[model samples]
Target: MISRGIQSNKVNGTFYPTSFILVGIPGLEGAYKWVGAIVCLCYVLALLGNMILVTVISASSGLHKPMFIFLSMLASNDALLSTSIAPQMLLVFWFQKRYIHFESCILQMFFLYSFTSFESGLLFGMSFDRYFAICQPLRYGSIMTNTIIVKLVIFLLLRAVTLFSPCIIFIRRFPAFRSNIVNHSYCEHMTIVKLAAADIRISSALGVAEAFMILGVDLLFILVSYCAIFHAVFSLPSKDARLKTFNTCIPHMCVFLSFHGLAFFTCLSHRYGGKRIPPFVHIILADTYLLVPPMLNPIIYGVKTKLIREKVWKALHKCQSPHVK
Candidate 1:
C-alpha cells in the first residue's frame, strides 16, 4: 500500500504520497473493536447533546438572548468538530480501513483546527457576555445587541479561516515524506507535518504560534473577564445577590476549564512528555480533548442554566405524558 501510494504521486519529478496509513492507537491493535465502540458512543452523545441544545435554543423565543445565542454557536461548533474526526476514526478502528487520501487528510486537518478556533472564540465571546451582564448590567442589552453578536460570529469565522489557511500551504509545500504512516488517529497538523522528510521546524513553529495566538489570547481575556466578574459579584449588597450572580457564571467556567484544560494537557504531552508518555496515551489525550468537551458542554449548560434546565424537564415531561394535552 505504501509503495503504491508513493509511486503514484511520484509522477513527473516531484514526490507526494497519494494516501497515508493511519495507525490507530499504535499498540492497541487487538482492542480496536472495543475502542471503536467507545468512540462511537462518545460521538453519538456529542451529536445528540449538541443537536438538542441547538434545537431547544432555536425553538424557544426565551432563548433569543445573547448568552443562549453564543451557546448555540458553541454547540454547533462542537458537533462539527466531532463529526470531522470521529467518522474517520471509526472507519479506521472498525473496518481496518486505515488509509486516508492525501487531500482528505488535509481537509480533515483544516476543519478540525478551524472548529477548534471557533470554539475558543465562542468561549471568549461568552465570557464577554457574562462580564457585561454582571459588571455592567445596565448596558448589557445595548452592548450585546443582535447586530453585535452577528458581527462577532462573522469575525470569528473569518479569523479562523484567514489564520489557518496557511497550514494547507505549508503541508502542500512538503516535497516528500519520511514515512506514509501517521501514528495518531486523525490527520492532526503536527502529526502530518512530522511525517515530511523536509525540515519541520517552520511548520512546528507556526503551529505553536497559532496556538498562542488563538488559545492563549482567548484564555487571557477570559481570565481577566472572570476576575472582574468575581470582584463585582463580591461587591453586591446581599449574600443572596452575590450567590445568585456567581451561579450564572458557573456553567461557562466549567466549560472553559474543561476545554482548555484538556487541550493544554494534550498539547504538552505531545511536545514535552515524549519519553514519559506512551504513544497511545498521547493519542488518547488528543481524542479526549476533542471528544470530552463536546459530550459534556450541553450537559453542563442544560443542568446549570435555569431556563435550559426547566425547558429540558418540560420537554421530557411532554414526551413521557403525550396524552395529557
Candidate 2:
C-alpha cells in the first residue's frame, strides 16, 4: 500500500530536512559529464541569443513595435526560465554536488513555476498582438500601445505570483518528509510533493489547477486568435499577400509549438508517468523540455524575421570591419 503521506514507524513524530539531494539522471553516471557540458553550452547559447534579441529590439528603431516588444519580453522570460534550472543541473552533473538547501529548493521551484506562468501570459499577449496586426491591421497601433504593454506586464507578474504563492505556503505545512532524494534534475512542485509524509492531495490539485488556469487559458486564446487570423488570411486576394502576412507569424508559431508541446508533456509525465517509466527518462525529458525552447526561440526568430536578420547582419559586419579591429 502506498503510504499517502502517513508517517511510518521508521521515524519520529515529525521530521524536517535541512537539504535535499537531487539524484540527477540516475543511470548515466560517467556520461553525465558529457551531458552536463552539452547542457552548459545550451545555457550559454540561450542566454546569449535572448540577450541579443532584447538588445536588438531595444536599440533598433524599426523593431520598436508592440510585437517586437512582446518578443523581447518572451526572450527575457525564456532566459530566466532556463537560468532557474540549467545552472544547478550542470553543477549537479559536473561536480556531483546535488544537495540543495530546503529554502533554496523552494526558491528555485517558486521562480521556475512563476516564470513558466509568466511566459504563458506573454505568449497570450503576443497572440493578441499578432491577431490584431493580421486580423485588423488598421487598428493594430491604436489597440496595442505602450500603456497596454505596461498593464499586461503587471498582470503577468501578479497572476504568476498570486497563483503560485499559496502552493509554496501549502508545501511549508507538510509535517515531515519521508525522503531527501529528489528524483529529477531540478526542483519542481510535484517532485517536492512526492517527498512529503503528509497528505498532499490539495497541493497536487492546486498544481494541476495552476497549469490549467494559466497554460490552458492561454492556449485557448492563442487558438482562437489564430482561427480569426487564418480566416482573415484566407480572404486576402493574393497568395503572395497571404504568405507575407503568415510569414510574420511563423517564428511565433514555432515558439508556441515548442514551448507548449514540451511543457504539456512534462506536466503530464510528472503527474501520470510514475510507475510505468524509468526515472532516467523522466529526468531527461524534463531537462530537455525546459532547455530546448529557450535555446531554440531566438534562433527561430532570427532566421524568420527580416528586420532582425538585417540588424544582425549589420551588427556582424560592423564587428568584422577593419577599423574596429
Candidate 3:
C-alpha cells in the first residue's frame, strides 16, 4: 500500500517523492476512535454555528451594518479555517489515511495560514469599527460607511493571499526533505517546514516573521482600539450610557481573548514547554487554537448580541413548530 501510494515527480530521468504522511496525534493510539468522534462533533458544530451566523447576517436587513458585516466575514473565515483541517484530521484518526499528496499538503498549508491571517485582519477591522462607534461617535457614520467596510474586506483577502503565498513558495523550493512523517494532525507551516533535510533557516525565519508581523500588528491595533474606546466611554457623564456603550464590545473582547490567548499558549508550549509536557498535550493545544475559536465565536455573539440572539431563537422556534395542515 505504501509503495502504491508513492507519487513521483519526473525530472531529468529521475523520480522524487511527491507525498507525505501525517502522524495525527501521536500516542494514545488506543483512544483514536474516541478522539476522532470528538473531533467530528466539534467540526460539525463549528460548521453549523458559523453557517447560522452567516445566514442570519445575510438574511436580516437590520444586520447590514459594519459590525455584522465583519461578523459574517469572520464566520466565513472560521468555516474555511476549520474545513481546511478537520476532515483530513478525522480521516487520519478514524481510518489511518495519513499519506497526503505533496501538492495537496502545500495547498492545505496555504489555506490554513491564509484563513488565520485573514481572521486576525477581520478582528482588527471589527476593533476599528468599535473604536469609531464608541470613541468617535460623531464621525462614525461618515468614516465607517458601507464603502469603507467593503474596501476593508477586499483589502483583507488580498493581504492574506499576498502574505502567505511566499511561505508556499519557500517550502516548494527547499532542496531536501528529511522525512515524510508529519507529527501533527494538520499541515501546519512550521510543522511541515521543520521536516526538511537541508538547513531550513530561510523558511523558519519567514514563518517567525509572518507571525510577528501580521499577528503582532493585529494585537497592537486591538489593544489601542479598546484602550481608546474605554477612555471615551469612561468620560461620558451618564453612567447608564457608559454601561450601554461598553456592552457592545463585550462579545468582541471575549472572542479576541479566547482566540489569541489559546494561540499564545499553544506557541509557548510548543516552543519552550519541552519534554516536560506530554506530546498529547501539545497536540490538544494546537488543535484547540484551530477548533475552539470557530466553535466559540457564534456562541459568544448569539448570547451577547440581541438581534442575532432573537433571530436564532426565532429560527429555532420555527424549526420546532409543527407544520400547518
| lDDT, candidates in the order shown | 0.87, 0.85, 0.83
Best by lDDT: 1
Question: Between which residue pairs do clashes occur in model 3?
Answer: none
Kindly give the stretch of ten consecutive residues in candidate 2 with the minimal lDDT sum.
Answer: 1-10
True-structure lDDT of candidate 1: 0.87
> Could you tell me every candidate's TM-score relative to the true structure?
0.93, 0.93, 0.91
Residue 15 error, candidate 2, Å: 2.4
- Where model 1 places Cα greater than 4 Å from the true spot, the runs are 1-4, 8-15
lDDT of 1 by residue, 67-146 (tens): 99999999999999999999999999999999999999999999999999999999999999989998998999889999
lDDT of 3 by residue, 1-325 (tens): 2353343543343233578788888897789899889889889999999999999889999988998999999998999999999999999999999988999999998898889889999999989998988777899999998898888889888988888778899889876665677888888777777777567777767776777777778888998999999888889999999887778777678788777777666555655577898878888888988988898888876558899999889888989999998
Give residue 260's lDDT in candidate 2 (0 to 100).
Answer: 77
lDDT of 2 at 67: 80
**Taking the tens digit of each residue's C-alpha lDDT, what string does model 2 give over 236-318?**
99999899878867667777767777777777777888778788877787787688888988887665788888898898898
Count backbone clashes in candidate 3.
0
